[model samples]
Target: MTIQENRERPERSGGEQSAAEPSPPDAGGSPAIAVEGLRKQFGSGPEAVTAVEDVSFSVERGSVVGLLGPNGAGKTTTIKSILGMVLSDEGSVRIHGIDVYDEPRRAYAHVDAMLEGARNDYWRLTVRENLRYFSTIGGVDPDSIADRHERLLDKLDLADAADQPVRSLSRGMKQKVSLASVLASEADVVFLDEPTLGLDVESSLTLRRELRRIVAERNLTVVVSSHDMDVIEDICDRVVIMNEGRVIADDSVENLLHGFDARGYRVTSADLDETVVADLRDRFEVTEIERSGDRTRVEVATDSDGFYALTAFLRSRDVTLDAVETVDWDLEDVFVELTRREER
Candidate 1:
């Protein structure tokens, strides 16, 4: 099915019976989502293209996980397989201990997703009307959740525009509305893709802060996929990184950033001439160099031993160190390092 059809699925039609209360995942503790050895391929024989291979991960209840990878790294395929949008070639996916393929309705009764930014929203419907409509389709009574919708609008800063047609709103506002619609439903598990795709700095920050608040308030389980490293680092408790259709790193943001041993440094010196700069480049991995008037700054990635040797060489050349700063590694740095290592 197309993405639009998938987004609108589990829909109730006229004359259909009211949906039963969503069954709990399992009696004992079960993960909100679990995928094991998932693999997917397209085409046949020599033309076959494997989009995902042996990707595995689990997300606990009431937590947020980020699914990350460059293009063609299987992030999309893996997500689709878990959501039952694509049938995988191997492995298993369970939501709350209920097999997705075996008991799709029970497994996904309390799940909702917002894919491709603002596309999930209805352009002609007012913001409030869209929320009520989605809630109804999700087997929820819109009137019963009216207070919840009000709170969502206030928290997302859409209260003023609650009655405005969605198409009349700005792009960033529409994105916020799409997210609100997903939360408007009674779904406990949510998937958000590129939640902040086209927002200004302030708008992005607002959405990020409100999303975290709403997730915590509801104890919701979230799986987010985005190209924004800062968004992942700020919002996710853990990250699952994919490279070449395989799982390369799965750990908390803190562990991944700290576990990486490579450290970078920036040094500024007024005495760094062309000779010194060339010599420094030859001896170390100098990633960047900048010269402003009489001051020159150099950035290098190295270990403790290499760092000491660099200082010694600079001293020998009579280069006075005007300033030195350690460059702390962020999520982007760790991601690049891991993906590059896999490629090598």
Candidate 2:
């Protein structure tokens, strides 16, 4: 069949089911996306490399989740396996209760994706035309979603250039146009990879705010992959971080930031000198030390127990504590700490 025919074809039925088809989904209560024991490898024998191994996670309905990793962390492979673009060597992926590998069309009926900051949009088509075209191919009547297209164009700052050809727009404009196309489809589940790439600071902020609003308004279940930690922290309800083909952390952003023992403490004492600083270095990981007049301040990384021990040591040395404060950590720090631990 031609590509056009395949795009327009209805779901295959009855005897068309494959021999490896998974069982039907549960009638009640299932996650929007569920991946279990997913594993994928390349090559063979001693030369083989495992890109992903025993990775599993789930996305609940109407939640925005961030899929994060450093380079070569198997993020792309996991996403492809979930989208049915790459067949996994093991495990299963389910979308809204239906197994993706068993029934791809049905599983992806309400799904859309913008990969690598772009979609397969027709560059020759006008901005509005691309939106309508994508909506049609995504199994929605173009006329039925006209209002959505208009809102998307307006919200994405593409309304003024709606009639212009996509090829005529700037790279950032084109990126926004691609996102508009995906959002125009009214898909329940969306996967956005680097959705803010190529956008300027103002445009990036606009996209982040607008995306959060749109997701809440439409109850979109979204999986976003981006190297921008700020974007992920601002938009995602939870994050799943991977390193070296394994999931190192999966939790709410708040927990990941404050729950780890990686917290740093800034302690100021009036009696600290070069000798005291050296003693601190011997006892703990001192990140910073500053001497101002008669006071010395030191920053140390440690947990609560270590902090207590530090206080005891300070008292033993008769160092009068002037002030102590906790240093705040952001998502990037947490991500680095988690991934570094995995590497160690």
Candidate 1 lDDT tens digits, 23-61: 555637889999999999999999999999998899999
lDDT digits (tens) for residues 18-120 of candidate 2: 3243333443778989999999999899999999999999998889999999989999889877877678999999888888777786677677777782234
Lowest summed lDDT window (length 10), candidate 1:
8-17
After superposition, the stretches of candidate 2 with alpha carbons farther than 4 Å from their true spots are: 1-27, 117-119, 267-298, 308-323
Q: The CA-based lDDT of model 1 is what?
A: 0.84
Candidate 2 C-alpha error for residue 269, in Å: 7.6
TM-score of 1: 0.89
Which predicted model would earn the best lDDT?
1
What is the TM-score of each predicted model, taking all chains together?
0.89, 0.81
